[model samples]
Target: MRVPDWIDETRISYDAVAGSYADMLRGRLAEEPFQRGILGLFAELVRGGGPVADVGCGSGRITGFLAGVGLEVFGIDLSPVMVEVARRDLPGLRFEVGSMTALDLADGSLGGVLAWFSLIHVPDGEVPGVLAEFRRVLRPGGVVLIGFHAGAGVRHLTEGYGGHPMNVYVHRRSAAQVAGWLGEAGFTVEGELVHRPDPKTEGAFVFARR
Candidate 1:
């Protein structure tokens, strides 16, 4: 399949900052009580469902956390460098280079899919297709946990993590808009959590079932 220019840009940008991004975010879960709690809830929802896939899993921090919580989990990232970092950092877990828009998993193969702050890289026009892919890879009653910045519009970053020069777009979406998209993609919205982590960004978590 032909990859989009933005996807290529995201992969290259992340590869350039993989190590620094890992270093900055590796222990971040410890500081966010709400996010950790949500992950715990997600693990419980899909505990006996089947194996889970952490899509767009950068450096595997969340993947490792999910594994530590006793859910069978693996990770996939768009950036090969990020996948390498994740593999090196979390040797016990599995990590691979892949895309969320076109996952390489069999239909109805996954019990749950986690997109923690990862879907923000996907442009608005392509978000539905990505959600459809999520629905396709999930079994009946499978759950999907999506974390994103809540609001509207996109922000361009010229430099990120450790002051590295990079090209990336951070898309902020409303919770209601995301819920509608999930519904359109054949997912039943279960619950949503919204919190203002900072003045500049609102964190949103949507839990849905297939």
Candidate 2:
């Protein structure tokens, strides 16, 4: 099968910025109380159910956090360089090169799936397919947590992460729109948290179950 152009572009962009990106976001999770709270609730809900897959786990920050909270989690990302950075930064954890459009996972093998601010790169037309993959890998009642920029339209990012050249499109979406996609993919919407730290940034977390 032919890979999508956006996937290649996204992967290349992340690969170029992986190291600086890791450096920039490292240890910052401790400062975000709301994000920590959402992740904490997710961990509690899926703890002991089974292993979790942190899909699109750029540099494995969330993966490490979830592991620290006692969930058996592994990281997967579209960029091999990102995976390498994650592995080097968190040597004790497992990280792999993979894509959310087609996760390299077994059906019903996961208790939870996390896509923290990673789905922003996925186009709207491909979201349902990605959500379907999430549902396929998760067991019945398995939980899925997704964080995305909450708004509408796409932003073409030509330069990012310390001025590295990039060819990526960041898609902003509404909570209700994402909830509808989850519903179509067979996930029961569980909760939605919209966070606006400032006028320029509007993010959201939508968690659901299979």
Candidate 3:
């Protein structure tokens, strides 16, 4: 399927820096275990054994991690280049080029959804709609784990993300605002965590489930 504008969207776009971005983050995050902790939140919230969907999965780091832990995990990103890098690095897994706002899977098809820092570039107005889409693809009792930079300003990241120019890449909002979006999407937040201790993020991490 052709990628959507939103998926193709973001300033520090995921497509351009696909390989280096993955390499950089994988090296930086592997020892930290923050990513593992965040996904673990989903395991705690959801009841199912999970045929999980890792939305906005750039380069499949978290997706591969979930699979390594024995969960059936499939990843989807908006950038073909990003998906390609993921497949190249992790040949045994499934990674597609798609947007979280319009997942290719069937409704209620997932037991859990993971949105890492992938949504960092999403504008505030678009989050509810995206979350609604997240809700649509998830089972009624599915879990959602979204993590991003939380603050009051509209931040746009630069070329470092390895994406396009028109794609405005960085954006963030308060924790309450994110919680509201999840609620609108029919999710019940089970936990909210601020991982500033990680030294890489300035925002909080939120875990919400349907």
Error of 2 at 22 (Å): 0.6
TM-score of 3: 0.87
Q: lDDT: which is higher, 1 or 2?
A: 1
List pairs with backbone clashes in candidate 3: 10-167, 10-168, 11-167, 11-168, 11-169, 13-163, 16-162, 17-162
Task: State the C-alpha lDDT per candidate.
Answer: 0.94, 0.94, 0.75
What tens digits encode model 3's per-residue C-alpha lDDT throughout 121-196?
6766778888988888888778888888877676555556444344465676677878878887789987787767
RMSD of each: 0.9, 0.7, 2.9
Ten contiguous residues minimizing lDDT sum, candidate 3: 158-167
TM-score of each: 0.98, 0.98, 0.87
Error of 3 at 78 (Å): 0.5
lDDT of 2 at 130: 94
Per model, state how many residue pairs clash.
0, 0, 8
Where model 1 places Cα greater than 4 Å from the true spot, the runs are: none
RMSD of 1: 0.9
User: Would you give me the overall lDDT of model 3?
Assistant: 0.75
lDDT of 1 at 107: 99
Residue-level error in angstroms, candidate 1, position 168: 1.1
